[model samples]
Target: MNTLLAEPGTLTTSPIRTQQPTGPRIEVTGRMHDRFDEILTPEALAFLADLHQRFAGRRHDRLADRMRRRFEIGNGRDPKFRDDTASIRSDATWRVAGAGPGLEDRRVEITGPTDRKMTINALNSGAKVWLADQEDATSPTWANVLGGQISLFDAIRRQIDFTSPEGKAYTLTTGDMPTIVMRPRGWHLVEKHLTFIDSSGAAMAASGSLTDFGLYFFHNAQALIDSGRGPYFYLAKLESSEEARLWDDVFSFSEQHAGIAHGTIRATVLIETLPAAFEMEEILYELRDHCAGLNAGRWDYIFSIIKNYRGRGARFVLPDRSDVTMTVPFMRAYTELLVKTCHKRGAHAIGGMSAFIPNRRDPEVTARAIEKVSADKKREAGDGFDGTWVAHPDLIDAARAEFDAILGDRPNQVDRQRDDVEVTAAQLLDVHVGRAVTDAGLRDNVSIGVRYLESWLRGIGAAAIDNLMEDAATAEISRSQIWQWIHQDVRTDDGAPITRDRVERILSDLLSTVERFDGDRFDDAADVFREVALKEEFPTFLTVGAYSRFLVDLA
Candidate 1:
């Protein structure tokens, strides 16, 4: 094996030169597993190398701009709509490429990692769409990254059925399968297993966004188009119209290179970030040729608010993680604005996730999940949303029933055109600080954060903790609220001040009491939770810091 250090603070992968006959110099640093070469084909890797060469600089620039914007916002710069992009917002002449075949009636969508079992379950889940998430729901391990692609490949080709080690067999249900809309990792992440070496003799980690998208698009675009569904995606973690533009360019280029027609790909943008909420119209306009719709990702949206306004005083601070529901004033403003904006532009307005997963062993837990999911989906359907998300397959029928009642025979209510809804900047920034913070809430946050991190380090991104499906975004919220409470000097309902010592004591106590599972890395997870939540300077994203430390360790 050969490894070379490239730059300061950059991960250097060790790769042995394998079979080489491609467009550019690229090396696979990860240990090759069963059928991994099928997805990491020479031609596919070359395609990714070229994408990196042409667009990596812009990705870095956009990420840098994000940092600058966050710093400015921390120093009292209000995050509102800009005067520069008013024309795009006002122009009503242009519309997106809209939903293509198999994507028209998305009343219910299931989200999960793209492992083999999940791939089979999601396709058979009776939902209209499957968000094959390679981001927050995936742990980004080398084996996992390759395994997900292989699973998708086989599933797309109708050859994914298999028997388990315990003799249980799994197969796709004989029905209209859910359309696969893959969600790549955000631009901020790097795929350390593959190093892209340019002509200048510099080798850097490949972009996780490009790596995931490139491999999937290269191998599946033509196959999907042949099936009349086309290549669809759910673009996550977009912060600006410029980032959206970059994706559009990538889509256009991929289409031409694959011999597919322009507008053959449809992408739904997740308006999850605080900055993204302000530039919704601009983002849609930028990706109009390939845009399908916009999804309201509530967990990350809340995390974004806490992250950007972390130091703006007690007014900007948040309550407990559980208390910050979708019914809050600011959250209400976000959903209302999303539906209004999307409908006005002839785009679908999708609702956020209902994270309540079912527990079969406990019927009461399952009952609550059904009740909560049914109510949430009803609210979204009544509010003019075209569809919604559920974490577990068991909750799909409950969610679909709500949409079926409202939608009736119509595919979507995009024509609703919520003209009566007019959201203002004040409403968007209107933080209703209540006295709901409690000792239980603080300890819950600590417990959830550490447990989730432990699971993530063990190569599981989606974990069921306390009967709810937890993802990276939820963990980010948990840790961020701890940081916000500590910095804002927030007190619980019982008059306990949130300080570093108090938080650490609670974290330490939870380590012994929290239930243990296989691959428990509590000590490491606690260290990471402490660094991100208890440190004075707020970390932009827990995954970012944790990935660098644990996921890509040299050891």
Candidate 2:
């Protein structure tokens, strides 16, 4: 085979100059031909022909139009937003996001299939999943060679079952090996990877963009279907509801082509752009028919958001690192929104990856970081995410544990805002402008309560502690939210395990301590609340008064 290397780490293999004989080899005889032809049928051949003809003439407009009709726009919609839709299959094979707890403890490590030591180390470790990535994690120099990709695939498929690096023979079942996910480069990588898997004597799933619009995905889906493999896809950089709607349509096409039922090809959407976040609710709504769940595409999303702002000048600030984290307020809003959005639609909210793994050489520091990640995942589960992802294998067990501790066996409880409450356009407007920014509104109550709680619970004023790295302004806001929940009444009258009185008592003392540390800040807080309340004619005092009475009694 002719082979050439390409920049950006792609392996390009030329088609063979001469065709091999169509029939099976003499060694296999009738069996090989029967297996091959059974997998690739006349219908599959016809489907591919039809797909090529339709896409040959740029025939994606009808699909895009169908998507647009499904994801409708309204008064709050962006006027300049174009109806750009991409196709993905809705038939989910695996759960879109993982379920059954301990997602936080689970870590995924990517090792070169050729790096036998790394692969063995990862398998030996307690990590829950390991992706033998043939994509970004590998060296560009190696990836540029066609032999490299093919060779790596072969190694992973063969060696994954072996017990030790010294070539010790041990029977390794699918469960013993880390859950294998191959992150291939793109659609072009399909033929090689799929062919390798077909020959390699291992089962694997194909990820990445197959069809950029429905066309590309369908082509790949057709190939998978023809191979008699269950269809699966990981959708990248989805930006709007229309994009999801297009996926549903793609599923319809795939089901018809394969003579399968709907929901056969499961898809996972990577939410990695600012536009995607805004369009999340609509996307979930449209794609729920076939969605596995949604994942936060952290690196890409952060990069996109920052780059957009940078192009607009320094006035709009975005964080530079994934580790820097979404600010407390923004983080709270985003996570809450994700959970609320997903649960509302009865889909999974998968958390973004915590990419860092502690340096193994430093046991103490690594252990601490691992602990923190686990804690964060617990918090995420509490906030409503069902599963999380990690880039390293060692962290998997811990990640899984974190999620399991929080979720237990119960089906997730949909949040109040998502389930019972319906947010109208007016409510959205009122909260965004009137309640969020002003003093005595939901924003102010949380701020005052945080300051108060920090004094009582943590022995510091909200102003005294730096909330975000250097952004002191967020510290007070951070305190407020914790305090808000602490002081708020969440007790159910239906004999629930927890009571409002318990929360109130705990928060009251916390808030009282803060009152002693910074009495003057409360004055400012009160003034802000007052200004917003009076200006908007809102019943702010009644709410605060009721909160105070309940908290004091509970305490």
Q: Can you write out model 1's per-residue Cα lDDT over 302-369, one digit (the tens) per residue?
A: 99999999899999988888888888989999999999988888889999897888999999999999
Give the C-alpha miss distance for residue 433 in model 1, angstroms.
Answer: 4.3
Clashes of each: 0, 33
Worst window of 10 by summed lDDT in candidate 2: 23-32
Q: What is the C-alpha local distance difference test score of candidate 2?
A: 0.40
RMSDs, each prediction? 3.5, 20.1
Hey, what RMSD does candidate 2 come out at?
20.1
The TM-scores of all predictions, comma-separated, are: 0.95, 0.49
- Model 2, 431: alpha-carbon shift in Å? 18
lDDT of each candidate versus the true structure: 0.88, 0.40
Best by TM-score: 1
